[model samples]
Target: MLSYTGGFVLLAALLHASWNAMLHGNRDRFLSMTWMSIAMAAVSSVAVIALPLPADAAWPCIVASGLVHIVYNVSLVRSYKRGDLAQAYPIARGSSPMLVTLGAALFAHEAIGPLHAFGIVLISGGIMALALQGRHVSRSSALAAFVTGVTIAVYTVIDGIGVRASNGQALAYTAWMFMFYWLMPLLFVTMRGLPALWAPLRDAPMAIGSSVVGGLVSIAAYGIVIWAMQSGAMGAVSALRETSVVFAALIGRVFLRETVSAKRWLACVVVAAGAVCLGM
Candidate 1:
């Protein structure tokens, strides 16, 4: 990976964490997510218009990515509703990088050394450790989070590949994917028994403000990762991007007053250490 691209990817992670914290802090996650998605679509559409469409080979992947992202957003909002951001964020983000690494190894034939293998295991362990709730979590909450984890893993791997396959047209694909991805969510919110879908917009100014901020952060995050994929290895970019989980945990603790146990802190350290090893 190019040093510049890696740096941008890290910045993207920070932005991603910030937006996630905001969503977690919100009184209505579904409303925030819906607005965020709309904002993402609008911003991405405008930015992507400056570039040409991706190659034919990228379209299928782009479409598939969009579909997966819809599921990801739904799962994420549900996870946030059920669990603390610190705990749920770690598990959801922790699961992805390892899955991306495995995908790269199996399909892209990237050679994995013992250190890399060990890093993946440590990351996964750390994530699973964070999954345990404070013993007050309901069984249904646990189940929903687990299902969310699966969706996260699936979407992360798919997007990693999709970005890589964009072949230097990462921005175009991101724009298209973000635009297309909102379709399902929009349809669901409008048609799926939610008469209150428009309720959040009753406060147009606040709605617009939150949507714009959330969307801009999201656009920056996705764009930087796409650019990173163009110049760097997908697995490495994905792994580095997953660092946002740790950042989110800190944000949650400080801002959201979300509790973090010593074990969870240690887990975060382990994941960071693994990332360091991978970086070296």
Candidate 2:
């Protein structure tokens, strides 16, 4: 079951990286993110109707996670705006596992075996290696990315506990969480008025299509991660999920045409070794 969960999370990591790459490649990331949220909210709205509601006990988690997710999204956009995907993404994603491990131990009482601890350390170290191998990233971008990672850790722990408290209603919890959290982005876009919202769509119709696709991919990726946490340790699952940094590095090189150093490729190998340790 642990191996199965690891594989599923690896898939989620790929999807997560793909969506972030799409967002990073866009001309107007904030606008694209707004549209992506609108798409997620639309799909989640339907799911919320079809599924049973999450337990009342889970409501607090959902609300808190929702607010943190807003911070995550905002910081992510700022991070991407300030730095290359390879640089910002690794710092943002790589910093989270250790934090999640600590948070899980403190808040959720999750025990970390020696192997899990080693894997988490390796993954985190390798990810930081990928980011720090090149010193081109601005301090501001690194800071924003680190803030994004902090939010990721906080929400991962929150949702991990919340899902367990949901009486096996993981899907319901996920649906409701997405529905609730994305509304903030939707509200932000709306407040900007119709013209501002429509400008991206009118100027670049392709942005709408990409945003819709990115939104679906994003929803699927996170939904899978949340579901996996229902059975897996939050820290282990988080460390495994952040293998997305490796994929993000590759995506940045291939799609975004960013320069990737040979040392960064070595970092990818280190990350892969860590993933193997976790899978074991």
Candidate 3:
């Protein structure tokens, strides 16, 4: 049976796919992403104020995660530029869990049982097949998606350790991390003159709407994942999170009207089985 934390992480996986689907439709994806980050920072500010202060030990991890998140965002943007949303998102999400599992095992010294290891393999393989299902993406885009996965792995392991060290205040630590998540994007946009940033918004009201909604969803999604990570195995939690790829495919079919093939549907089943294995 799936543990309660596993169940919650599955919930988070769905939310994660929802927000990313919203994001994929943005004409000015970078700007929409900026808006999402700004929205997250704004809400996180409230969380920081309302939640109890994180212990001093958590600060180091918060700082490290903030820096790493910049690369993650940039890499994601690059991935989008190179490939279609359906392809890019799955590649990034699918590749991440395996890397996270390995990182946890080697550096964090987290022990994984054989079943969890097989689950990670299934997830990675299924997602890889799903990512390659659609129109061919540029190699550069594929590389960027792979890099996004790596960055995700790094930050995830960092946050997993940091959250555990927080004792019971992991939420506050996450709040602070979200508060700074927008800094890198903000700086890049500002460099071209802040006016250039908002100029794109004038033409794309729908993108703006998605940004606001996606922003809120992403913040809550990560918050839930971080909370689960504190109690669950980071490797298991990370693998379960990638099941978002299955949801992404369905979202693409339903809302985006993209044609998803039957083979891809089978891949989704493989991904689901991996997630179930992790939960067990």
Candidate 4:
């Protein structure tokens, strides 16, 4: 069941990349994400009402994770705006597993086996190899990309722990988390970017559709992953779920017409192999 669920999780990853590709292709990236966040909140809020809430202690972690994720979203859009998608995306994503693995060791007290360490190194290296184009990426974009990666790692590990603390109701935990998750972004938009918000909201139907699809895809992806974890191993589930990076790279190359150099394809293969090893 774990292995089968892991495969389903990979489909979830593909869905994740699909929506992200949609957002990346859009003209109004930030606005699309904001709309998506708003829609996601509504959808997840309904789920939260239908499902059981997470344990009380998990609430704090969910709130904190949402705050970290808000920062991540801001940094991610800024990074994408300032840099190429192929370059910024991988860097931001590649840096996360290392942080999550470390957190797993220190906090979860999970034994870091040699295979897991090697898998992390391979995944990180592969992502970096794919991202480093050495042209047009400014220092600021690079910094933002790295910071986004760190935030991803923080939120992933926190969510993993929070989900575990739910006493087996991972779906409910996720629904509750998403309900609060929408609050931070809403408040940020209302408080900080009030003027910019109305204009984007008024002008674009494509933006709205992109937001809705992105939000739905994102919620579904995480829902599959949380369910997978209920019957699967965390480290394996996490690694498999992140295979979205590979799909993202391929999508960027084929759909977005970004370069898919031999080196990057090779790196993607290596990372996929590492994920397989983590599962094994």
What C-alpha RMSD separates each model from the true structure?
Answer: 2.4, 1.9, 2.0, 2.3
| Selected candidate, larger lDDT, 1 vs 3 | 3
Per-residue lDDT for 112 in model 1?
Answer: 71
Predicted candidate 4 versus true structure: per-residue lDDT over 1-280, tens digit per residue: 3556767988988987787787788877777777777877888878877887777877877788777867777777778887766667666766666666677678777666888888887877776665564566577776887888888778777787887777777878777767765764566577568767666556777677777788889888877877776555566676776667788888899899987667767877776666655555
> Candidate 3 versus the native: TM-score?
0.92
Mark the regions of model 4 whose C-alpha exceeds 4 Å error after superposition. Answer: 184-188, 191-195
lDDT, candidate 3, 162-251, per-residue tens = 998887887798899998876955675776678767776687767787898898999888888889888777888888888888898889
**lDDT (C-alpha, whole model) for all candidates:** 0.73, 0.83, 0.81, 0.73
By TM-score, who's the top model here?
Answer: 2
* TM-scores for the candidates: 0.89, 0.93, 0.92, 0.89
- Rate residue 155 of model 3 by lDDT: 95
lDDT string for model 2 (207-230, tens) is 778988998999999999999999
lDDT of 4: 0.73
Pairs of residues clashing in candidate 3: none
Model 1 off-target regions past 4 Å?
137-143, 191-195, 204-208
Better of 2 and 4 by TM-score: 2
Index of the highest-lDDT prediction: 2
Segments in model 3 whose C-alpha atoms lie over 4 Å from true places: 131-135
